[model samples]
Target: MSIPHEIENYIKLQPESKRNDMLELHERILQNLPSCKLWFLDGKNEQGKLVSNPNIGYGSYLMKYADGTTKEFYRIGISANTTGISVYIMGIDDKNHLPQMYGKRIGKATVTGYCIKFKALKDINRDVLEQAIKDGAKPRF
Candidate 1:
């Protein structure tokens, strides 16, 4: 019903190992972005078909589209995937920025345009990951 309740329920539904990691990431995000707006998406498209994994979102920013329209979306997000977890750092204009800046330093994580996906918390450099999150959380407009 509530954003936090939904997030906690989602994380609790994860496997033990993943649950702990997800909880930790959730706390970390809250600590880093203390006043952020929280969100929970049940991974369905408008048609209610399962499209993506459930996402726990943080912060807020205005996103502008090429069509000269804008919408508010989360600045950072975390989700449990089939293999591991995905940390989404939305609003980066340069697709290459993340991979170039954090690909090598964030350990085994895959640094895409707006996501850092890893198998486990211990597999990556947490500090670099935090910095990346902070970088992405900066004002988007």
Candidate 2:
């Protein structure tokens, strides 16, 4: 399958050591959620200044704010960080869900409420990570 130009560029821009990891993770995510929506964020502010690492997002959900406003956003996001990579699991109401569910099983990764940070794919258990991603993608409160 052809990836969007923006997402392609995002992967291309990563360091050599990280490019393959990004691509593999991207493909793994697709395999887990075939035909899911794809999203790319350039990590720029309105003025075009870089603010965060570029993100490759998957799936969709309507995010409600306290002020009653809502916006559509991705349910899962993958991004390259200075040290390694991060997988963001959005929309989980219980902040402890991730750590409690997958912390010990996820290998060397750091499991936070909505983010899984790791140095490399080899450092983490892919099967466990996949499970977390799948569970995180589901709608829950």
Best by lDDT: 1
Write down the worst ten-residue block by lDDT for model 1. 132-141
The runs of at least 3 residues in candidate 1 whose Cα sits more than 4 Å from the true structure, single-residue gaps closed, are none
Give all TM-scores, in the order shown: 0.96, 0.94
lDDT of 2 at 136: 89
Across 1-141, the per-residue lDDT of candidate 2 in tens digits comes to 344788988888888879999999999999989978999888899999999988899999888899999999999999999899999999998899999999999999999999999999989999999999999888765
**What TM-score does candidate 2 reach?**
0.94
The lDDT per prediction is 0.93, 0.92
Task: Please state every model's RMSD to the true fold in angstroms.
Answer: 1.0, 2.0
Q: Considering every candidate listed, which one attains the maximal TM-score? A: 1
Candidate 1 TM-score versus the reference:
0.96
lDDT of 1 by residue, 83-133 (tens): 999999998899999999999999998889999999999999999999999
List candidate 2 segments past 4 Å from native: 1-3
